[model samples]
Target: MVSGSGVFVFDSSGKDYIDAVSALFCATLGFHNERLIEAATRQMRELPVYPTALNRTVPVVHALADALSAAAPIPDAHVLFATTGSEAIETLIKTTWYINKQRNPKRHKIITRRGSYHGSTIFATRLGGIESIINSFDLTGDDILYAAQPRWPRDALAGETEEDYAHRLALELAELIDHTGAENIAAFLCEPVSIAGGMYPAPKGYFEAIRNVLSMRDIPLYFDEIVTGFGRTGKMWGSQTVNQT
Candidate 1:
């Protein structure tokens, strides 16, 4: 592709194609947006890049964090920024592990669904459900567990209702937790919508049932909203849309 406008991209041969997937699912603002371009130009001129460390950060970084905290769905949200989506997800994984260890030293495992893509980092890639990516890595960790993705249509019974399917899936999670020992488990990480499995949202009441199961052992649920964030699921976050919040 040579140039783009709105959601359309033009190739070298002058063929136009719709950037329906938002350019690998992150470029939602489209291409050559005047406002974005202007902001970029201005920021580059003012402060191109700064390493936020040793208790020091640029004003724009702090401003963005404040804005995101106010805009986030989670109550009293705190923001942590990363250079890329993969790095962001990796940060989340590390943060959860750190907190979990502080809470309980044995609580080190993280449960995620099958057919979900978390990130490309070694640890994040292990948490992801894609077999191809996981296999590509020579490094392996046993703390991550895989549960079935909550796509009711693909895994539901012939006559099962959404509620029933959700409950069943939650039951499976509970069983997995029991087998693994709840005391040894950390948080359950999830993609609000499946990325590896074609962007399917969880079934109705899926989060509710999962929450019920997690509540028994005080397990926290964390959503990786890289895909279904920014009103992609008709809400600011997919967690709100799927009742995960």
Candidate 2:
């Protein structure tokens, strides 16, 4: 049993330990933050909850959306809030399907990397590449594809430089796309830094190479920055940290 306060949590025996993982990487401001509490209280006192669907929304939701859109790297980017990261991943997956179904009906598959962990929902779990998580479910289908992870320190060839490794991985991704048929793929989803799979940051130029390939094919790239967003990777977003532009 444990109780939390600030950045520390006390165990059953009263031995306090610093929460190094930020409560599974969500509590960036730590526990018992008075400002956050005050904000929540203020919102509750005003309009605590509201639906955002069917053209219904509250001031706070619009404010959040405006802030997020302003901060996004992409011009004209919009925002959608989900209750959890899993739901967000689900939304991404569904959005990809929806867009492709309308624009390119055959482009319904998503390409992710080996060892990536997207979420726990059916489609999200299938999008993930961890065998343990994937095998637990009956999702032996082709809607999701897996490519090699760009972990240089571990996957690099003995004589390969980081640039060479990145190039090789990009080639591998291109090969996968070719084999799968670009018309059958919707997008390539990835984490700028593979934290949950392992702390495997992309090698220099890795993202650029992959982005080039995807761009030539006109396939969209989705960045799952749930863990690495909001300055977790020493930048506003891991995409920026990894030089993805």
**Candidates' C-alpha lDDT:** 0.85, 0.87
Cα lDDT tens digits, model 2, 158-199, are 999999999999999999999889989998999988877788
Per-residue lDDT tens digits for candidate 1, residues 109-148, read 8899887888877777787888878877764778889988
Tell how far residue 130 is off in model 1, in angstroms.
Answer: 1.2
Best lDDT among the predictions, by candidate number:
2
Model 1 misplacement above 4 A: none
> What TM-score does each of the candidates earn?
0.94, 0.94
Question: Distance (Å) between predicted and true CA of 122, model 2?
Answer: 1.2
